[model samples]
Structure formats: C-alpha cells, structure tokens
Target: MGEKLKLYGFNNLTKALSFNIYDVCYAKTAREQKDYIDYIDEQYNAERLTGILTTLTDMIGATVLNIARQDYEPQGASVTLLIAEDSMLPRSQTQLAHLDKSHVTVHTYPEYHPETCIATFRVDIDVATCGEITPLSTLDYLIGSFDSDIITMDYRVRGFTRDVNGKKLFLDHPVTSIQDYINPEILRRYDAVDINVYAASLFHTRMMIKEPDLQNYLFKTDIYELPPLTRLEIMNNLRREMIEIFNGRNIY
Candidate 1:
C-alpha cells in the first residue's frame, strides 16, 4: 500500500544528529548472558524489557543490570535511539517497523554480542536529511536492560498515523513510569560500559533516519536517573500501573 519506515543503529542515529556513539546498547546484565538484555536502557522501552533483564540477572547470580549500563564510561551508557514514521502504516508504535526476519540472523548456541543493534536502514524524509538505524539489534536493549539503569540516551523519533483515530487516542495513557512521576535519580557516576547485544527481531530488517531539521523534529535526547525512587518503588508502581492500565504488558 505504501513505502516502509526505517530504523538505524546508534551510529547512524547519532551521525544524523551530527554526533557519534563510540559504542551503544549497554545493558546491566552478566558478561556471560550479556546477549540477553542489551537494548534495555533509559532510551527505549519495549513490552517486557526489565523482566528479561531480571531473568538474566537471576541466571547470572549476584549480577546487576545497572552495572552493565555504564560499566565503561564517565558519562555512562553512551547510546541514542532514532525512530521514523509515515510509512505503509500509521504513526503508532505498532505501525512502526520492528526487527524482522529478512534483516538478520542470530545463532544462540555459540555466543552473543549485545554491543550493537541488529539491522540498519537508510531513510530519507522530505528534503531535510538522511538517517539510519538498526531496527533489528535495538530490541536487545528493550529486552535486555530492563532493571538496569542507563544514565544517558538521545533519540530522534518520527511517527505517522494510518488512521486519524490511532494518532488521536489509540496511544493515549493516563499514567507514567514511576521514574516519570517520582524521585528519579539519573547516573551520578560511570565506569566501564559492557555491551551485550542481540537482534531486535527476526523480521524488522532495515530502517532509516530523516535529515537536518527533520532529524531535530523526529529525534530526541533524554537522560535517566537512578536511586531515590528506589527500584522497589519503581517496580511496585510499574506493577500497579500495569495491572490497572497496561493489561498484560511488563512495562506500563
């Protein structure tokens, strides 16, 4: 019916913004199972990201997700997310392109790396600029860094709606993440960053980033805080909200 939306890796996302990410997608899991939750950070939130990270922690035993986020840098988890819309579908999260099979392949038996996104796309929007992202590898961040704390994140997002209703009410919610509501302490320090990456999905394949002002319009930058809010408080609040509004979603 229409063209496809595109997603790019942090490298492409940042490059579009005139910045560069040394290494992105830092998660707070174990080095062994680092492959599990690479994308779970402050920048992006998927359905069950934190839970997946906790599972990795339990498997890691005595490991933590916060440690995985900024384990390497002073600024902490240096990564950014870029999103684009106005494609074959509407401007909804569901309408956005995700990891697809045509883009990448992962072999779990050997070993996994979560430092990078899975797929990269070349995008052109209007006449402003050109951008890119890895729709595939970005998933690990969402699915991996659940309970982990990511200090810094920047992204460019663009959304289009297929149906006007989808843009008007289909995505509206009454609540915010506990961090969005209460005491949210971002990263105060940093150390070594550990990137345990994975593919966002088997299908999403490739995506793109717009350009120039379009990049500014679609892209965004955000920072996350840790402590004060208390992980327990965040979890309880998240759980309560999930029960009340999120239906079966892990993150609300």
Candidate 2:
C-alpha cells in the first residue's frame, strides 16, 4: 500500500460521481415505441437494478447498510442503497436500522418522442461517498452496465480533510478528468470531451459512441430489409438523436 496519509482524524472529504447514459432506438410506429418501452422496463426492473447496485457496492469495497427499491407505474424502476466504508463499521452492526451519508441510487426513464417515432432509455446514477471510498474506481463498471450510446458524467470532491500537521486538503486524489478512469478500449469506441474546473475540484466528461452501426439502433427491424434510401433516413435520425443528447441541445 502507498504511504498512508497521517490525518488529524477521520477523513471528512466527500467525493460524488453522477453518471447519466442514454440508449436510443427508432421504433418506426407507435406500437413499436410502446413495445420498446415495455421491453426496456422489463429488462431493467427493480430486482435487476438492486442486483446491479449490490454488485457495485461490492466492487467499491463498501458495505450496504440499507436498501430501498421500487417499481413505478407505467414504466420505471428505482433503487437506493445506503453504504458505508468497508472497515468503518462492524459487519454485525451494519443493518437497515443504521443510516449514513454515503449512498448509491439509480433511476431509469424509458421515453418516446411524441411525433418522431424515436425512443430512448436513460439511466441516471449518483454515488456519494465520504471518508476514504472514491467513486471514480467504478467508472468503467457503470459505463459497461448500460447500453451507453451517449454518456455524461460529473465528478467532484467536496469538503476538507486535515493532515497531521493541521494542513487542509480539499481533494485527496488527483483527477484530470473522469475519462482517465475509463478503460482505453472503451475510450477508443467513443468520442469524448472534458470540461473541468480544477480549482473547484470538479470534472465533467461527455461521450458519444463513434461510428455506431446503424443496425444497432433499430428496434424489431432488420437493416437488410430496408432500401438504401430508407436505411440512410433511419441512420440520419439516429445520429441526430445521439448528437442532440450528447450535446444537450436540439438540431434542425
């Protein structure tokens, strides 16, 4: 292990990671759009989401103190996990009755356009940890957990921890960008951009899949069956959707 920092007391630094991902599809018709939403809903139900969060807890070496999950009406699922640093609390003492500031939450949204026949599934996850646990370690796992046609992530370290000499350190680790934590293979597949405020200890990264295959965006339709012109139209629409979501704006 690297030389441990001699701290005045418990580490008071709070590191938070917020990840948002989008999966886009062309349903072609209202019925297909409904089917797409239903399919996504069933694919990521409360139970599955709970499993994902539990795995994340384990991956980050955290203890799950409590869990609350729900499946919403229409089409959505939510899961919340209250977690504690791995060795901070005894196993027997960590129970649902206990509460902590650290948490992992995921909320899924499956939506469709009113007139464009475009459908999208978006998952938003927020991981906030205090003390020694850092959420940046799970960046790859979070990206791989979803379809992730377009991804937007924000990470920031807040609060201050005192060193043995009574010096305050706002950030415990160095973070140039969230992309640095992502795997090179994954990074190679996406075009990524970073907007960071180093002085504020905040970093943001946005990514969109580069050279996405047109067939992957079609729901219940085969690209081979479509004429060249029709295929072009669908590809254009899908690319437009991805661009809009990645850039957070609409395009004509």
User: Which candidate ranks first by TM-score, i.e. highest?
Assistant: 2
Give lDDT: candidate 1, residue 139: 29
Alpha-carbon error at 56 in model 2, in Å? 0.8
lDDT string for model 1 (109-216, tens) is: 112233321111111111111122222123233323322211212122232122223322211112111122112122112221222112211111111111112111
Residue pairs in candidate 2 whose N, alpha carbon or C atoms collide under 3 angstroms:
none
Q: What is the TM-score of each candidate against the true structure?
A: 0.17, 0.92
lDDT of 1: 0.23
lDDT of 2 by residue, 90-162 (tens): 3344311212369999999999995777899999999998876788888888888889999999998888876
Deviation from native of the Cα of residue 127 in model 2, angstroms: 0.2
lDDT of each: 0.23, 0.86
What local lDDT does model 1 show for residue 242? Answer: 22
Candidate 1 Cα misplacement greater than 4 A, ranges:
1-150, 164-252
